[model samples]
Target: MDLSWLIPIVMTAGGVVALIALVAVLARNLKKVPPNKVLVFYGRKHTTEPRHDADGKVIEAGGTKGFQVVTGGSKWKWPILEDCQEMDMASFQMKPQLKKIPNKDGVLVNVDAVASCKIKSEQSSLSAAVERFLGKTTQEIHAMVLEILEGQLRAVIGTMTVEQLIQDRETLNTRVKAEAMSELEKLGVGIDILNIQSINDDQGYIEALGKKRTAEVVRDAAIGKAEAEAETKKRSTTAAKDADVLAANNQAMTFEADKDRDVKKATYDALIKAEQARAEQAGPMAKAEAEQKVVVQQVKVDEERERANIEVQKQKALVAAQAEEAKTVVPARKAAEALVATAEGAKKKLVIDAEGNRDAAVATAEGEQKKLVIESEGNRDAAINAATAEQKKRVLESEGARDAEINAATAQGQKLELEGKGKAASIRVIAEAEVYQAREVGKAQADAIEAKLLAEAKGILAKAEAYAKMDQRGALQLILEKLPSILEQLPAIVEAAAKPMSAIDKVVMIGSDPNAPAKFAGNVPVFLAQLFETTKNLGFDLSGALKKLGIDATAISGPDAPKVD
Candidate 1:
């Protein structure tokens, strides 16, 4: 009776379990794809609709690795029988530090960079990324990106210089990204940011370069300052001389004007006096002649006496004029001599003082000044002689005693004027000499500074020109351009090296024979050492670079080539 009741309850529970199992199987077969991810279904033994061309011909193609990928959609798969894989479409970051990378100039540098990479958005890109990196962790993907970027960085750095790395960041970044573009595209990785965080050097080369440039700038500044100072000094000296000369000329003009007015006034006074004397003498002579005529018969002796008396008056006037002329001439001559002596004494003292204090060049300049002064004195003496001759000629041409007296006064005035003019000219000459001396002194310094600048400019310009040809891109261009020249010099280098080998008496293989593997391997380092030695004077290792490019340097050198066998 109990068994009959148990059968009904067990049958109801079994029916409920079967319903739940069917629902679970249906749910497990269905998959929902997210918007930013792809769902790949493979090994499901299913086929999509056949693709056709315009003619509707059936062209069935199998998916790669028997895999069908559906992106951003749902798919069906057997639960626990097929595998499901997922790849995140999110961005990833890769930070890497490239260390001690040698640049084009052989400078060691380091670059720390950060890059943001992601799977490309296209369906094909998703397929590629899923195939290559579907199971890889986020850290693993980042590591792969770093490895790719490091490889590209090494290649780019090999072609670039330290300056380009530091200063040409845009070009450097572009080159780095371009270098990894094809590889990343193949793997469906898109680089969003290839940012160079920092670039530095292990050596103090950059700092040293800055210091060198600074020193060069300082030297140029010092030179420019000295040149400017010299120019200013020259201008100042020239302006000073011009001012002094102008002042001397103005003073001479003033003196000459005063002398002219004084001479004119003295001549006018002398003429007035001469006219008065002529009037007074004319009346006396007429009276004497009339008396002589009247007493001609009675007193011929009286007439002679009258003539003698007129002659005596003429002689007395001449004697008085001679004494006055002598008085004026002697005093003027003595005063001129005193002034000349004083000027000579002043000149002598100045010259002696200058000689004691100044250099030999200054003394030489002073001597030139003295010569000019002496020549000027000779010119003044000639002028005086000419003035005296003019006075004598005027005296000889005189028609009367009054005219003679006027002529004498004019001559005396001319002598005074000549003396004053000579003194003023001497003073002007001395002042000009001093100005010239100072100018010469300034000019010497200017010449020295200019010469030094010119010499340094030439040397620096040559070096600058040589260095300017060494820009990273330009240097590569030059290497390509000068390849022929380098090839041409190869023969000469071989010849020189051969000369030393020819001088050597013997060569012996100590470690192993020529055909030995260890000997052959050992020769590579020896040959490299010899090559480096050969190129040491050239400032670069050409052979090493060529060998890295797969060039046979030893073969090129021929008989004189370093042994590598």
Candidate 2:
């Protein structure tokens, strides 16, 4: 191959290939432009036509039909016939500088705030309409955004004071959001929020307002404190007045009570005086009545004395008349006696015969006395014999009684012996049976006690092991101290056994010894003394036992020991 000829041909081929690649790139770029941007076509007329609903209902007039809105991607169109401009839908922050406009209160304040917004679809379409009407540029959009936000912000700031704008940010923000949102919505744009970032005002005005509020608060507090003090004083005054009124009432009541007491005293005194006067009159009136009665009784006595004197005089006269009559009858009686004497001689002999008969009667009585004497002697002899028989009978009865008594006594003794022997045998049998039973029981109890003691010992060993491991000297010391107390109770056990056997012979024979075992001879006293000593040393109680022994615990310590009696 010839190198020189091949170089020109290769260069020509490379140029052709490059031209093809350029055309392919231009075609690819044309395809890519449709996705990245949008195109809007505007006709000669700037006015928009009315839009219609899908249901053929008439809607508001909007952008002209020659103009079209393209969003998100590009559109294929004649470049000469349409103009395409990109209006961003993304949010943007617009800080608008606004001049101080006086509020309703005529206070000037500079309002600084931020507005967040995005272009609306309808307003973006209106760019084509605006190009027809005014022109198409960012300047118009920026002017529109600023014009809307600035008018709204100025209106908001003008409605409020500088203090409100500064302090009440939330209220300011709410006003901004409302006004800006409504305005932006009307313009087919979206506003996120309108914030009053800051407000600049005269410091003197703010400080004066703060001082005024503080003074008002302090004045209110002072007024409240004064009112509280006044209320307390009023209550104290009222309480004092009430106390005075109560004291006066008590004084009045006391005076009334005293007056009542005086009235009662006067009434009691009058009653006593009247009673005394009546008592004094009663003795005088009684004396006068007694004197009148005595005078009447004396008159009756005088009348009775006069009547007695008259009766005595009448009796004396009657006695004298009877004596005269008796004296006259005495002479006649003497003459009659002389005549009777002659006849008496014969009468004397008859009287002598009567005297002899009387003597004979006397002699008969003497004979009767002798007969009575004989009968009396016989009766005396009979009485003596009867007395002798009675004495002999009494002696026989006494002898029989003695024999009967001896027989009865012998029988009673035999019966008592049998009964006593039976009773003693029964008691001995019962005692033996009880002892046998007790021995069995004691063996069983001993076994139980041994088991319990073994178990306690095991437990004590376990506890001691634990205590030893822990080195607890206190527990070991307590057990050692208590050992004597347990041992001291042994005497009580013996006493309990012996107490039920008081009727048994005092000299007990143990192990077939007739004489008491040496150990048993003084065992009770020795055991008791040992128990007392052990209990005393162990601090065990023996006051109850000392009482039974008729000894006072306090007295037993000295020469003043109580006497056994």
**Candidates' TM-scores?**
0.35, 0.32
Lowest summed lDDT across 10 adjacent residues in model 1 is found at: 394-403
lDDT of 1: 0.65
**Candidate 1 C-alpha error for residue 201, in Å:** 0.7
Candidate 1 residue runs with Cα over 4 Å from true position: 5-8, 45-65, 210-565
Clashing pairs in 2: 34-74, 48-64
- Candidate 2: which stretches are off by over 4 Å? 1-38, 43-64, 79-83, 88-92, 121-134, 207-544, 553-565
lDDT digits (tens) for residues 458-537 of candidate 1: 55555456655566555545555666666676566546434533564753433223464554344434444455443432
Model 1, 158: alpha-carbon shift in Å? 0.9
Best by TM-score: 1
**CA RMSD, predictions in order:** 54.6, 47.0
lDDT, candidate 2, 1-565, per-residue tens: 6599988899999999999997775554342134333345454344656767799875566554546555555444443554544444456678887755676577766667788876555544345333432334656666787788888887887788766776788988888778876776655566776777766555355567767878998999999999999999999999999999999999887876775675465345434433443344345446744764564455445434444544443344334333433343333344334434433543444345444544554455445445555667676555445544544454455445544554554455555555555554565555455545545554555555455545655564565456446432453354346546644754665455345346556542323334436534444444344334433333333443455447665443333322211
- Residue 276 of model 1: what lDDT? 42
